[model samples]
Target: MKAGRFEQAQRQHIATLVRLGEGREALAGREIIQRSWRRCVDDYRLDPSRPRPVRVLTHEALVDSREPVDELLYVARAGVDQLFAQVAPMGYVLLLTDRHGVTVDFRGHPDQDAALRRAGLYLGADWDERHAGTCAVGTCIHEARALTCHQREHFDATHIALTCTAAPIHDPQGRPIAVLDISALQSPRGLESQSFGLPLVTLYARMIEDAYFLHRYRDTTILRFDTTRAFVHFNGRGLLAFDPQGRVLAANGEGRALIDAHAQRTPPAPTQVTQLFEAELDDLLALPRCEPDQLRALRLRASGEIRFAALVEPRGVRSRQRDAAATDAVTDIATGATTASHDPVATTSTPDLDRLAGDDPAMQRLLGLARRLCRQPLNVLIRGETGTGKEVLARALHASGDRAEGPFIAVNCAAIPESLIESELFGYLPGAFTGGNPKGMRGLIPQADGGTLFLDEIGDMPLTLQSRLLRVLAEQEVMPLGAERPVKVALRVVTATHRDLAALIAEGRFREDLYYRLNGAELVLPPLRERADRRYLIQRLFAALAAEQDGAVQLRADALHALLDAPWPGNVRQLKSALAFALATREGETVTVHDLPESCRAGLVSAPPLASTSATSEAARVRRESDDALADPEGLALARTLAQASWNVSQVARQLGISRPTLYRRMRRHGLIPPNRREALRG
Candidate 1:
């Protein structure tokens, strides 16, 4: 084979660009053109000084050719094929060229086949720099940079109808391996040609670079950064890079958003790549790094603004000294125990309490209060609707308390049989009752001696047991049946009840004195219906449960809407059960509306309109139903009196012909408890 006049000219042009730079940049340009040139030069085994001989680089030649030049050309052609197929719907063509800029593969619309072939724009077409100067494929290859040329940008008048963008794809060593070009018919009025064509070309080039890097350097970390390191090019979401000194270096788009929210302020720059390197250095130097079994995320205040970050030290470097110190600090912070030394783990591995995963203000406040309250041994009383997770709050309290290492005994007072309630709580002595143990057993109160005792449905306890419970709580001791002496116990008591204790007291069903003792420190857990955090709860529940289940079972948009609209009489418990049921019923991938249980689906359906003859009749019908659902005589009297009395409970009670206690009880029953007072009602 021999080289043509155009091929000789292109080689000269590429050689000129290589002389203008030095080292990596210069080498990069030379490698790109040399790889492309080798495809033709080696395939025909020709000298460039001779006249050019043409041959199409088929996929078979690429796969079967033992030569590296043939393999590279084969890969380039394959990539061009894929790019053309991907963007074919947008009416674009993909072209691949040799180092001398001759078209090796031209992929595009079949409708333009005749026109393109006639214009010498098909495979084996001569597009060397000499023949097509300043064009996308030729100029980008000649300049060793990405270029976009549209319509009249072509030096050859015959190529005026095309808008093309070409980017030089580089290998891991920063050598240009091939040029990726996307060309479309010139669109004089639309922006799609420029926007889609240019971006698509850039993307294809990046994909090639990424694939090459991953293949060549499998062991080394290949961190891909955008112009700024604000968004890393990989799939990991919200990844934030931290320095050894605990400074934030760079954050991905999602990570930046989280950091901004935590900090409650925006960063000065949109993206800063240098910050990432600096932070990496600081992170590496902070302490002896160790890989964590699970990466604990941390959010801290920097420059008076909070930012989210994670410490990811490689595995096997964590020493016992580091682990002990870190564990001690975390335990102290969580349990309100003695402060531990400022170890690296203490400083770097603390979990972000702010990111505990809920969006409701009430939930946020509850978490904040839980964090502060965890440091103490105060008895807590959580009052909420039945399915509102009284137990979850109790567990959180226990886990966050000093006695987390000790037992957490939870007893449901209402679930226990009346005859067994006393024995179950206070334990029993040998021969104290029929079938009694030979040796006296420790009761729940004693079992929870070093930790927390969660008494659920305390209001439902029989009056006889209430007095005994009050005695145990007041004396901090319990006397088992047939025991001669009381056993002293050290434990925190947390009680929950769905019933109104004051109403029980007024009915003479509960002891008033006992109520005050248990209400020492109250925390009212809001019912799901009343909680503003339903959306947050849904997200957290899905995230927590989805990982355990087999297939994809995300809530449908309609399901989420339905969940938000439904009155959750069963609260959090019902929500979890509903999701479980939906997951079980999911046919293929998604949890559709049809997968929901009848009860949930029914709840989702809008209630039917009441029959009416006239417009006024319909309005009255609607109002009547609304009142029936939300306003009884007790609620109406309370609402009216509160409105008239200027929202003062005591004044409203006096005006509403009820005692203050009676008014409060009715307000709670009617779900009229004010947001502020609801916290008070927790006790």
Candidate 2:
């Protein structure tokens, strides 16, 4: 129908319903739209004929407001891209909004960018009920569910021309973090015309939600199940992660349904693994992964209903069974320090740097330097691999500094969109641009005043903004996008990146002056493979994690050996990921070689079939290294003699006709940890 005809029909219909005291049921819209219409008429007092213009945040303000949802934006990137690819062909535009109903991320045809922006469908658009009344984003957020607000259903006259379908993307804790919306400037008026919109938006929303849940609970045991075996592995819907004691950590919508059904409740209450399953926790842990035959016998505790189950294990920690006595020990494993029995995990205000690196001279030296510089306002540059704990070091620096009382603001330069990065770091004035907010907003840089601004992945920053950042670093003040004057800020700047800025400078991609400004004090972190204190650090990391999980995690000797031998190309980050995977999958309290990830286990597997070029070469290198160890007959004989003598250094040194230091040096060269240290840790 034409706009003029549609408007006449809608107004007449609403007027007739209002006269009959049934304005809500008079339309084909859902209850959500009816409620919104009532609110528009009653509370907001909006005129049906007079529609308000859409409100948008100034670019700088938008960036600052979106910082909390930046990770969600990053996580939604792939899903949004896939969603757009599926719907853009049909003239649909997708907008992802923060919980406040502000469009933080948008995907649409470039040719329609101007039209979309003009229609308030672009980034920085705020679709909250007060802003964009009765629309999909606003109504979905208010309703906290999926729904379609078709044309003529919208309370705002301006938006009645658009059809929007929206679904809420929830966090692991079940709170809506953002809304995924698909809207069209023009679409058929019939309700059946956009029937596919709801399912499409909900499907992608679930996908994004599942991605978030998996990432958040990678260290926990994930139980995935469905009526059919095939869907268990492929579908993200029926998924749940549990703690060691079987407490529910997280669950997807489908898994929640299964859980609710088992409990015989409309909405499931808090549940534990023991409460839901007939089998013992130990038996469940021992169950094979993704095996249809094994899953056939699995039954729910409440109704004895059969379901297929697949377990996803954490890859990082080695799993081993604890003896009755060890299991009953009072020591806290999570923090690697003894605490009262009230809680297994203890919270700390300060970073536990000691547990992060155990007795490594290089790390200790860096920590000492960092501590000294923390008292001073130095711009520290931490250079390390992506997973090498650069941010942790930055946090440590913040906690150690005098500015620890102030807020610690962190910005991932690479995670933010190019057009918005500046405004995110700086503030903006009201009316700075088209569709901007009536009231001005403060940026992140000013928000970090009297605190610390940790700029992560700074190397990814564009050269265009380098000069602006340099000015901030030198003058300690920020100029808002359209402000006439600069505001002074007293804060320390710390930056970290995996990329080499010197190389970037050589390519003319990074500013040399900016590099020098941020490089006031440089701390280089060593990769996990090169660190000599691997055994202690590994134990510490697992112990801390075990405590946090409210359980005990131990490493079998073989598992420990595999961890020590694996070339961790991704450094500490990779190691943590592997450990988390192993912990989730391990059958018992102790992680064995079989419990580790395939990449980590491959090195431990003797004469295993080559799967890839890298695996083949790694096997060959291992064999050659083992041959070299075998070739050292004297060293092997000495080691055997030491083992026989119960690792008595003096006895072994005397038996081998060498000085004690020489024996120690030889043991170190052969990659042998001192038996005393190993035994003490094992105990």
Candidate 3:
């Protein structure tokens, strides 16, 4: 019988008992047959067509099979021994089988083993339907499901001494793969023994299936859920639900939180999907389904919460063929949603400014200036040390500004060859050079029309091209090499340079006029050393990198401190390299200080420590005294001003003159805060 059909048959049998008013009496037979069927299927991989026969196979004939019978026998014998040694009080016989439906492996206690073998129930026996009709392993295999049998339920009269439970193991793709069975000699206690072991056998089968699936479908999304709707799956974005018709059904914890606060206040009742998004859904579904690139915001009816969602239908002839081959392969689950339009001022045209990572006041100031400049079409000059993220800041400005909808074409001036710089920048006509394309090319400036053009390493731009670049900026037109006509270009230029352009101009290496043109609104980025939050950078880098490595590694406390104290000459780039190297060499959970590269290790050891114990103790005392004296408002203001001026007596005197002495007296009178002259302060 087929597995599905067997289940149907069992259900029918149970219904008949209930209808006959013998439901309670039928339980015994039901349990017995279920256990016996499962055991026969699991033990011999059999089917109903070839059920166990009336006569049992002799031990010698069973052992004579050349098929992988010895391995099965060994495991069965071992299992039986273990059952007797540990579960002897329970008293159960272990049964095993080969890939085929044959009882190649079996075991029992020494006393029971001898008696069972003599009774034609021991090793080398074939319990398949061919030999014993409607048996455990054989029938279950045929049904491709679990089964059980109870005492007196044997197909053959010679098999009256046993009861069994069995289950079939499936491969990752749900094919009936293997069988496991357990049997016990008949006892006066009835079918309870087989019933008790049914779930255990079933659980083992499930474990094997799970492992197989995990391996086979490694790329597919896997979801795990707890009783109360918590997500326990790995690499999951969020919990989501979809109706049979593919409508948004529900969302997980984090998704619900993202809805507008007002929307969350009046959420829909349980099992109710918000109707507010009906119009939006209709519009989305109405749009041409040919291309799925366009995504729109979905707003909830009850809570006014909004989410971004896109529909993706399989594309291409190949995809259709694959879909036909595996109709059930694709799951129509709602993948996830991100917050939509949270800030009215922020738009798609606005560059993703917030992507830049830093908390320094200088960086904040630069960002503020970038935001303001984004609204106007003005040239921007980004000045910073190499690897200090100048280009990142420039991209942010473009993304946050009004022209964000325009293209962002970035060209590294230093990387391009000097000879090709002009052609590359201004483009060329067909056959403009020896190997140039016959068709004229659009220059970078023309290509960047109606968008932002980022010129990185602008300082390295050859002096000859500087004048031509200035002309383009001045005229808003680019004349391609060998092209007769000048192309009118509208572009916003954002240039970055590590070298001091003003210094270069003074040295006659850069054009003075071009420098002024590119420096329309200069934003200088401070180096990592100037940022006080080195500790924050270390922690962020470590956490971000560790997440990328999955569970491969982590950094120890000492290693993190070493990272913080070391002067990052290469800034973030150097830090990332060191972390990556350390993680690669790490043997266990944590990366020790010694795991760092030789350069980083040397830098950490060579650097002067932040503050010695004695210095910290003294500084602490000074802070206490300062805090005590600044209790009064007037005294506090004066103390702050003095501290701001670094407590320089001459500068203090110049600001507060004859009153300086008197202010000094007053400060003493008010317990003036003393300054620590040891540490230098940057203005």
Per-candidate TM equals: 0.42, 0.53, 0.39
Among these predictions, the greatest TM-score belongs to 2
How many clashes show up per model?
Answer: 15, 29, 40
Candidate 1 residue-wise lDDT, 341-423, digit = tens: 22211222232333332557676556655654564667777888886777667766776566878877778787788998898
Model 3 spans > 4 angstroms off: 1-352, 551-553, 602-683
Tens-place lDDT digits, model 2, residues 152-179: 7777766767889999998887788999
TM-score of 1: 0.42
Please give the distance, in angstroms, between residue 481's alpha carbon in candidate 3 and its true position after superposition. Answer: 0.8
Question: Could you give candidate 3's per-residue lDDT for residues 498-616 as a string of tens digits?
Answer: 99887888889899999888888998877776776666556555554454445446678888877777776766555655665455334457988755553455453464543556655
Compared to the true structure, candidate 3 yields what TM-score? 0.39
* CA displacement after TM-score superposition, residue 185 of candidate 2 (Å): 1.9
Q: What is the C-alpha lDDT of each candidate?
A: 0.56, 0.72, 0.56
* lDDT comparison, 2 vs 3, better candidate: 2
RMSD, one per candidate, in order = 30.1, 19.1, 30.8
Which is the better candidate, 1 or 2, if ranked by lDDT? 2
